[model samples]
Target: MPLPVPDRLCDLPYAHLLTPHTGPLRSDERYDTVHFDGGEYTDQRAGGATFLECAFTGVALSGVKLRQARFNEVWAQAGRWVGCDLSESEWQDSAVTGGVLAGVSAHGSALRRTVFRGCKLEAVNLRAAVLRDVVFEDCLLRDVDFGDARLTDVSFPGTTLEEVRLRGARLSRADLRGAVSLGLPDGHQGLQGAVISSTQLLELAPQFAHALGITVKD
Candidate 1:
């Protein structure tokens, strides 16, 4: 068997012509090539389910158990998922736009080639997760935790990360060049492998200086 290519470029998801679906999201169920439009799947238990080539529009899911769920080639728009348990879930080639995810527990999740555009992720727990080639474009990630997580080739373009926790997180080629605000309340020790522009550095110099106990006299 050939070795796995780590640096291979990931292709974006194509337009899908899917079958309309109307049913409860059950555990261990596989939803393939289905479109969930204008559905309310709140307070449901869909642990260990697999969603492939699926699309969600205006879906509402609160306090849902989606642990160990698998998602591939999925597209979600304008979905409201609050306080959902999505820990240990794996997502590939997924795109979520204009979604509201608040107080979501998604720690230890693996997300590859995923894009979150114009989404609001407030107080989401993503500690110890592994993200590769993922982009957060024009998103608001406030109070999101990524402690001890491994991030590779992740870019946050046009995003504002407010009070985001990065303590003990590992970053490789993590680009924050286009982030409107990088609010790291945990200091800057875990950003050893990240790339930031000089302007950002200058803006954050005072914070880092305070953390290092260095006083600059003007």
Candidate 2:
């Protein structure tokens, strides 16, 4: 069953923050139009929390657990998340821009109409996540895993993917027109159903030929 949304924001602890708990902390909490800027949190457990129309700017979180949390119309800008676990979270109409998410686990999460721009993601696990109408622009992804993730209507513009794995991810309608990456597994990489101009294809023909060992005769 879905947890009930809280009426007020809970007071955050100040010191001795890195203890791991069994159950959810700050569960069923809700915040409407709340602002949290330049706050730092470490080793806190917050699962099944809900945020509505909240803004989190310049907040740094580390070793935080957020399972089954729901974020609707939230804006998180210039925040950093390190070693955080956000499995089974649901984000709708949210925007996360200019953040660094390192060693984060977002397995089985669902994002709809979400935008992540100019973010740095390293060693992030997004296994079995569902993304629809999501945009990732100017992001740096290193050692990120998106295995078995569902991607529909997703677009990545000017993103750099280094050592990232997308194995078994459904990307039939994903657009990666300006994404930079070495390659993918099983020869299923690159834009499949994305729209590109004729000039762009012409410019990439030689590179594609070199990769496929195709000889072009003049």
lDDT of 2: 0.73
Candidate 2: stretches off by over 4 Å: 1-25, 182-218
lDDT of model 2 at residue 139? 92
Candidate 1 per-residue lDDT, tens place, 1-218, comes to: 11121221122233345788877889999998888888887789999999998888888998999999999978888899999999999999888888999999999999998989889999999999999999998999999999999999999999999999999999999999999998998878688899999999998898899989999997
Model 1 weakest 10-residue run by lDDT: 1-10
**Lowest lDDT 10-residue stretch of candidate 2:** 11-20
**RMSD of every prediction:** 5.0, 8.0
Winning candidate number (TM-score): 1
lDDT of each: 0.88, 0.73
Clashes per candidate, residues 3 or more apart or on different chains: 0, 0
| Cα TM-score of candidate 1 | 0.91
The sequence of per-residue lDDT tens digits that candidate 2 reaches over residues 1-218 is 11222222332221122222222336567655566667787887778888776767788889988888898866777899999989999999877878899999999999888888889999999989998888887899888787888888887778887776766777757776677643343333434554445665665577668778899999
Name the top lDDT candidate: 1
